[model samples]
Target: MIRAVGAAIGVVLAIVLASAAWVAVVSSGRVHDVADAPDAPVVIVLGSQVRDGKPMKFLSGRLDAAIEVYDSGRAQAILVSGDAHGRSGNEIAAMTEYLVDAGVDRDKIVGDDYGLDTFDTCARASDTFGVSKALIVSQGLHVSRAVALCRDAGIDAHGIDAECECNWLAVVRNYAREWLARPKAVLDLLSGRPPAVVTPPDGTLTAVSRG
Candidate 1:
């Protein structure tokens, strides 16, 4: 029994190691510096948590990066993908307002309010929004998985590392979460799971242009 338990433990460790290595290998060179990727036309800003209708620091970093990319002409349109009306309120509303307040034109901002997760955001970007290629914006720790999932969803996707100002503890937590998340992200791609919200063919569920 003890030997069997030890074998099971070894298998678990091996799986973790393999998963981590897979992410590292697959993600290398897929994320570029925002300043260097001036040709990317559309950017997808993945969602993070919002508190009191304000973006948390990481989310702010993503928004800032997207704004910078847009202003620099690296991207013409910015898609803010997040929960529309979740328990924490409307992430897309907050994201859109933040961008508009920061000088991004309301007409140029497309809000994907149903992007409840990274997978959903990527899937909907292509299937619903009709986006063929995009730059993803998120913290460095999370960009790899974001890019991978987006590519799997049929969008020619790359990522730009967001400017993260998170504390050490938060950074550690983010990395830890990502290690687990990477595996799940790959599985989600292989499984071809449907998005939580599907846009109607009549274009009724189109991206919200606050303009």
Candidate 2:
């Protein structure tokens, strides 16, 4: 009985990993292009890690991709959302700086300093900023998840994929991580509320407003 139970557990783990592999395989090849209907509004550049007060190489590529979409005239505004958690590190400021350096006008940039994660970013974008819809930008594997959560939050979002031009090895690494994240995301969604907002000492995130 012990052996049989162990075998069954192994099979389940294999299935879970296999499903993520399949999702990565099919979703990897997909990407969204800039096709602004002459009036597409804000283009959100989903934030990535910025270590040592600088844009990581992969993050740089994403910022560049978002700039291209913005320059294509599809979006009038650019939203940079990420963790501005704790006074020690700030992802939003880093993202905003990248936008400025990429030739996106400073005024056109909106910093979502409170966005601690993908779910938080989308939820806050709609609930706090009053954005019902906008073009969401991220790599294909990640973008789909972002779009999925945003849709759940009542945001009319259009995901503009940016993974095609990404480094395949890096994307593969991300896809692998998504396998684990996918289960948690599903659980969070089923539980229903926006996964309880995370608040920083100085600004927005929590519903109570520590400020």
**Local distance difference test scores for all models:** 0.81, 0.67
Candidate RMSDs in Å, in order, are: 2.8, 6.1
For model 2, residues 1-211, the per-residue Cα lDDT tens digits are 9999999989768867765564444334333664442334666677777787776766666677678877877667777887677343577787788778878778777778767777778777777766766777876567767767777778767677663455779778888877667656556666776635644332222221111
For every model shown, what is its TM-score relative to the native structure?
0.89, 0.75
Task: Give the Cα error of residue 207 in candidate 2, in Å.
Answer: 22
Cα lDDT tens digits, model 1, 45-133, are 99888889988899999999898888887777888899988787788988989999999988788888889999999888888887777
Candidate 1 matches the true fold with a TM-score of 0.89
For candidate 1, what is the total of clashing residue pairs? Answer: 0
